[model samples]
Target chain A: MAENTAYDRVKAARANNRPTGKDYINALVDNFLELHGDRRFGDDPAIVGGVGWLGGVAVTVIAIEKGRGAKDRLTRNFGAPNPEGYRKALRLMKQAEKFRRPVVCFVDTSGAYCGIEAEERGQGQAIAENLMEMMTLRTPIISVLVGEGGSGGALALAVADEVWMLENSIYSVISPEGCASILWKDSGKAADAAQSLKLTAQDALDMGIIERVLPEKEMGKEGFYSVLRAELCAKIEELEILPLPELTEMRYRRFRALGAQQLAGE
Target chain B: MPFIDFFNFQPKNELEKGGRQSAPIAQDDNEPAKTCPNCHRQIPLSQLWGNDHCCTNCDYHFRMNSRQRVSFMTDSGSFTELYAGLCADDFLRFPGYPKKLETTRNASRETEAVICGTAKIDGRECCLFVMEPYFMMGSMGVAVGEKITRIFEYAAENSLPVVGCTVSGGARMQEGMLSLMQMAKVSGAVKRHSDAGLLYITLITDPTTGGVTASFAMEGDIILAEPGATIGFAGARVIEQTTRKKLPQGFQTSEFLLSHGFVDAIVPRAQQRKTIGSLLKLHSGGAENG
Candidate 1:
């Protein structure tokens, strides 16, 4: 195999054949019970979140599902959540806090859906509410970037005690094509945009934007699941030991210190 | 008076630029003559500024740059800028981004898109952050985010109220993820300010869309919008394309938002100072002078 460039990894991350959030839940969680509806509005299929057991500890599992087929993709809005989806995710998170269950979110989305209805329903407000609410949630949270973590949509679920990413996953503020179109007036320069964006998991880890990078090199599905499960279990155990106040403070401080390091380097 | 046909609206030319390209405000010749896009009436630039950038003929709200907005809102000679020293570097080293930033700096006469400071709004001291739409559509980048965070932090420390005037296209694409991160960074600061029980107000002007709308702009305790302002997360064209449906008449405008309960009030530019002062006074339990 040739060495993969950033753009190549982006393609790999977006590969339809690659395992999705539902696959991870099936492999990692025990007896997961899927929940739906935001209670304020109807259900949003783009975000799948519910209760499950992670290593004998009941936890809230929320993940963006791109869906399996063309029909499913339409149903899931190609993993781009509407305002209701975010609201649903937040509802589950609040419930998790009430039960003191740890939250484990899998982020994979092109972005929050940018449509007329979505905007009318307060897409920005939904994401904003989550960011503000997640900051002070008493329960611990661990977010994994499973695939395309694009913009505010991904960040809505990613403010956590630990944010991990799959090796090939792409996390960016805007998609390469979008950036290319905006910056160069051409979407064909996506490869160049990818390089400039520094959106690979390795770049994210190096920038202190993410906590860990899970390697998926040459691993079969079973092997990948085992590694992910083990790592997640370890992180959960480590986090569960800390007091709630300390964990919350740590989460707040982690985000607050983000751009300061880069600024210091300059 | 012409019947206000909301459905037959022509999208503001300023918003059509989408913050990527500089609008007509970039002209360096200091041309005194200007035309209102809404009414298509010729007016002197001085008249526009004097009217808080509203068209004299049709009362069309024109986008105000950061300096103009600050000067218009704050008490005379009371603004002490907080983070003027902070500037955006070519963090990603994207091609031509440095040159673009330099050009924008010279053109806008500002280091960054946002001007954050401590100012007196009708004799009430508050921490303020105003976005300059002239500077790359007032896109939120690292510096804009940091400045906003600093303002919130300062407001929290001093127990002062916060008044942010938002006008932006979205996050800066040149800075890539760095620009997007401002949403979270500024949102965190707003959270901290809210937790501190300090009053935080947001005034959406002309156009406030994208990541800025998704973050601090929507998190205000009292959300205010200029009449006729466009406030939404996605651009109108993007929404139209994605939904494959025509948007409703006056969609995303301040009047629409007010009816939908998204905005607390739709303030006309002339009455904004008095309205904001009254809100501050009410919050602070100051004696009502009216």
Candidate 2:
């Protein structure tokens, strides 16, 4: 018999396949509202963002949600967004700043889909616009890695004041399997890669790369939900106190300090 | 008595004597530091280095190191290195990795595999980052990403054009996802720089592959490649194995990529400096030619 990991076994036991993160956000964050497309073009399903209340403090929430089944996956573009997805997020982010609401983002995706349609639609331009908006946005923003956070698609929403990662979630430029295949010339090196990737939440937090790591013990998916809600709530409470200018300045400083640690002795 | 004495008066040992004495004339440095491999003759390395590390003899192209490239491409000595202290640590206790890193460090005299700085090209000031393959294969580790992103931010702050010469084997496996995260980090930086209406040029040199290729390597206002360089995401072997067929010759080469529209152009190394300088000037609308 194959040895099973706690993460895989738990995911299997839950059988909880929500179609999109939008579904979970509707069920979880209070007073949720959905925003429409970029004014320039049409709406993109890969990225969805709007204003919502997380523990009574209003926050702008944007997430990259992958569909569960075939139909939904096709609709969601497997969470690989086009240029419009990023543009939509940027629109919401700018609106969030105008309203002085804190922003929260959930990242879950493989990467931005690189199909001909997306490229022609200016996927690169879209992501670039979002990064520019987020860096200059005048509000506290927090990003949660609820699942796989891949490359520019994830980073589009991931530039934030604080980044929280779930115990089983992974964040990377590319997947560990992809890394192994590229480096070792063999896909089978994936297992060896997991150890080397340091993609797990604990490893990321230990490196001071991320702010916090939400834990998981006896509880399964519900536990994940609760931890996420609590963390968002607590962080929201703490961040709500700062004035808009201070929050924006702090956010900029936070990103500036990222990756500043010395690597020689570490 | 011997077969050697049949045709010649002098012994074969005379040739060995010439080889042994005079410290070998330092192996003919008079050849101007470069030669055509096919013709076995001097090719004017200085002129070629000023050009872009190409051999003038037969135009046999060569990859330029990041520093040589920056000097050749940038205006005068305008470069100011940014984020110079960032580097990678050997986290996994990787076999021979420490030794390889040490050797590369001493050889290249750089803290990391990549270098980021600000410089002027064709009278247009731009922030530039060049990844040096000589150092740990120009692997994207934490420091590489940090330097790249910081330079991007610097570009955005200064509202300057950005030129990135991307050449890397891939993410550094020893550093793991930290190395991989650079893809996001640098891509984010590139995105920000581009969104600000700043011109960003991504130039791919020989062997640009893996995550680097997928990310910023392809993300540029104007994409360019060096002639004969292999530029692709999946290596030739993987694609060949997947298709169960031999890849056509030069499948991932710059010529192929350019022909396929994946690359904007395939530039001879000797013309890269002039080409990039001209492009920056054209896009930024600075002084036409410096």
Say which candidate scores most in TM-score. Answer: 1
What count of clashes does model 2 give? Answer: 0
Q: Which residue pairs in candidate 2 have backbone atoms (N, alpha carbon, C) closer than 3 angstroms, thus clashing? A: none
Task: Chain A only: list TM-scores of all candidates.
Answer: 0.96, 0.85
Write the residue-wise lDDT of candidate 1 on B1-290 in tens digits. Answer: 25786656666776663754765555445667678888898878877877888898999998778887888998999999887878768877888988998899898898888999999989888999999998988888888888899899999999999999999998887777767777877887888889988899999987899898899889999999998998998889878877889899999999987887788998999999999988888888666773
Mind giving the per-residue lDDT tens digits that candidate 2 earns over B1-290?
68886666655564545755534333355655666664676666566665456665666667667888788878898998877877766765654567878888999998788888888876667888999988877888778878888888888998888889989987676675566556656666776677678888888887787667756787788889887887765556655544466666666778877776667887776577778878877887545443
All models, DockQ values?
A: 0.41, 0.23
TM-score of 1: 0.92
Best by DockQ: 1
Tell me the docking grade of candidate 1. acceptable
Q: Please provide, for model 1 over A64-99, each residue's C-alpha lDDT reduced to its tens digit, 9 standing for 90 to 100.
A: 999999999888999999999999999999999999
TM-score of each: 0.92, 0.71
Q: Residue A180 CA error for candidate 1 (Å)?
A: 1.4
lDDT for position A45 in model 1: 95
> In candidate 2, what are the lDDT values of residues A1-266, reduced to their tens digit?
02544234223322335324675576557888889798877888888888878767788888887876889778987787777788888888888888988888888777676554454454544554455557657787889776776655677787777888766666665555666776686767765555566566776787666898765452236655666778788887787788766775666565555455636522
> Candidate 2, what DockQ?
0.23
